[model samples]
Target chain A: MSLLSLRDQLRSGSVTPSGLLDDLAGKIVSRDPEIGAYLSHDLAAAKAEAASVDLSLPLGGIPIAIKDNMNVLGQPCTCGSKFLSENYTSPYDATVIRKLRAAGAIPFGRLNMDEFAMGSATENSALQITRNPHDLDRIPGGSSGGSAAAVASGTAFAALGSDTGGSIRQPASHCGIVGLKPSYGRVSRFGLVAFASSLDQIGPMTQTVEDAALLLGAIAGYDPQDSTSLDRPVPDYLATLNDGVKGLKIGLPKEYFGDGIDPGVRELVMAAANKLAAAGAELVEISLPHTEYAVATYYVIAPAEASSNLSRFDGIRYGHRAANPADLLDLYRRSREEGFGPEVKRRIILGTYVLSSGYHDAYYTKAQKVRTLIRRDFETAFETVDAVLSPVAPSTARKLGESAHDPLREYLSDIFTLAANLAGNCAISVPCGKVGQLPVGVQILGPHFGEAKLLQIAKAVEG
Target chain B: MSKPHIDVRYVANLARLELNEAEVAEFQGQLDAILGYVETISLLDVSGIEPTAYPSPVFDRMRDDEPHESLPLAAVLQNAPDQAQNQIRVPKVVADA
Candidate 1:
């Protein structure tokens, strides 16, 4: 059932949290072997947790899947890398997980992802690549692929996902669901395993925009533990879901519709815009002139920071370590060698090279400067329109091995979604339509802290 | 920009990966292509703009230094491949020196 529909049933006592948990367990048991959405499940603890939930809360026992990168206490937080396969158990629930639990939501399991949230496709996962439920042969976008697939496949009412450059939205789009990457500071990252720490933010993925709003409301707030979390007042995302999109000016960036975007995906997104126009919203042709620079800038900035964040995985304190090393250096090398996947290793090298002494000023420093111009491009566009509309990916989900042979093709998958992230603005991807039976996503991007408006506009289009 | 000819062994060593020669050759081509696209970032004119680091302007919201409850030793070690006295165990590391 859609999370919103499930919420109605929950409020009326037709489905208990325990019942939802049972249903989720059954779904996982039946479908997960093929989809490989989950890395770990704690049914006994989940049931015990669900049994004690206070049903008066808005979430009221809704089943939620958490991305494996976020700590859920007593569960393994592998971050989809073999290096972390056996070394860590979250000492305590992440701030978001605690909030979900308090809201009477059941945290059913931890989902798979790109190792250390590095790759754009889930194929880099050391566990298993999560397949799109819409078509098993196609990839369920990543690194939040498992979360999106689980939600899209009805394994949970809604799932929590972390976005560092379109990890949440792209996969959600590919799976024919709704995914939100909130304003950078909107959601706390207290217990999220760091992956390009500056770019990571946790958000929700669900079947409908309204469900995304409901999930957002439950997990967003100020957290003293996360230095980047905003101290600003949290809005009632659900309360504003019905705000009509009448008179809302939506900007369509010409750069996003250019040659690389598939014609079919473009048509579907344009149709979504037309539907919004029919519902009384106005559309304006806008230009984010530096849109072409986003992929370039994102690669530099994300990797530079990732290099710094991943330094903690040394064989010293926590995580996997190699056995019977000849020396300390060998231990460090072998442990890391044994632990990280090909993509993770690739990023660490690229990141390290960029941040190293001689190249730092040339690559990392220069990329940061470009990031500002990219952000300004959005600021200028938002001034002319209430929200920006575009396709979430350049095309529909490619078949499982289609882009794997070429890593650049894989990185290009986030071309459309990265700009919203680089600007630190809130954006959501909703399934606009199908292109040749494959789902396509239309994105709604707004100014910083504009999640409520974005969700409102998304809901309008959802109808 | 002309693509750099990536040395598979060098790249793998830098990345701390123990790849066989076949894996190295395969990754050499993949890394070269990815780097080729990433090189496009250098073409942008970011002349005077300040680097956009964190998404929001707010910073330094750290928690107090007071200790919170720690996980039980057993729970922490439940998934460890090797452990001793509540700490994870790893191979020695002196050889690189």
Candidate 2:
């Protein structure tokens, strides 16, 4: 059932949150073994929470899946890695989880992810890889792959997913759902497992733009725990969704459509643009010339930040620890080696190399400079247009093992989506069309804190 | 000018990862290929542009320091590999000291 339909039923008391939880549990029992979307299921606790939910609230006991990277008190947040496998249970609900519970949303389960939220595909997960619900042979995108697949497969009304690079959008694109990465500081990141500190923001993946807006409204606001959370008043996202997109200036970046984008996906994106044009929105051809540098810039900046953030996991404090250690260095080595997956290790090494004393100027500093140019490119483009339009990914979901042989090919899959994260802008991936049954996502990007406007535009396009 | 060879031992030590010989050899090939592609950024004329460290111009959204409630100690230790005295236990570290 659509999340909107579920919400309506939930609000009218036709379906109690407990009943919904039972139904979800049944679905998980039958389907999750094959899909592997869930890392841990708390059916009894979830049912109890659901039973106690006050139906008077907005969410009203909607079943919601949270990505494993986000702390849900008492849940095993493995982050799809062995490093924390049996190491830590969050001491408190993440800011988003608390808000979700406050709005009467039932916490269903913790979903799988790329280890440390560091991969573009769920294949990097040390645990079972999450499969695309639509095509089991293909992968759901990462690092929020499990959340996307769960929502796509009707496991939840909406699922919370974190986006450091293209995690949320790419997975949403692969799963054919609506995923939004709100402006970086718009959502509090107090309890999120940090990947790239500055780039990471938790957002929602849902079957509809309206649901995304509803969830975004509940989870977004200032938090004292998160030093970077924006202190602005949270806007009424649902109220803004109905605003028509007439004369809305949509910028089409020349770079997004170039070279590697698949022909079928491009056709669908252009068709979506044409449909928007037909709906009275004006399309402006724009140039974000520095777009090509986004991938390189993102790799450097994300890794540099990741290297620092991940240092806390040195077989100490919290999370995974090594067995009987002969020495401290051995403990550190074994704990990290056992905990992290290959991709996470690769990123850490790359990041450490870039930040090392001698190489900082050439790699980290240069990449930061490039990042400035990338942000400038967006700033200049935003001046001429209200929002930007692009493809969420260069192509539809590839087979599970297709890009595994070449990591660069895997990284390049995020090319179109990375710029938004790098620019710290809000972007959404809305299913534009299907390519012989595979879904293609048309990405819509808006200025910082323009999530409401972006959702409205996406809703218009959806209509 | 040639691309610098990434010292495998240095990379492994920095990441605190133990790489077997086979894995190291495999990673060397993969890293070289990946770096070759990433090296394209060096070709761009980024001369005067200030490196953009963050996308948004805003900085430091600090909150007031206040005592906040924490989850029960038992609940926090539910998934811990090893714990003692309500604190996480790790091997004695000499390097950090």
> How much TM-score does chain B earn in each model?
0.75, 0.81
Best by TM-score: 2
> Residue A212 in candidate 1 has what lDDT?
87
Model 1 docking tier (incorrect/acceptable/medium/high):
medium
Backbone clash numbers for all candidates listed: 10, 5
Q: List clashing residue pairs in candidate 2.
A: A83-A339, A368-B51, A368-B52, A369-B51, A372-B52
Interface RMSD of each: 2.7, 2.1
| Lowest lDDT 10-residue stretch of candidate 2 chain A | A83-92
Q: Give the DockQ (2 decimals) of all models.
A: 0.54, 0.59
Over A168-209, each residue of candidate 1 has an lDDT whose tens digit, in order, gives 999998999999999988899988999887789899999888
Query: Candidate 1: how many backbone clashes?
Result: 10
> Model 2: per-residue lDDT, tens digit, B4-56?
55676687897777777876786787767766766778888878888766666
- How large is the C-alpha RMSD of every model relative to the true structure? 2.4, 2.0
DockQ result, candidate 2 = 0.59
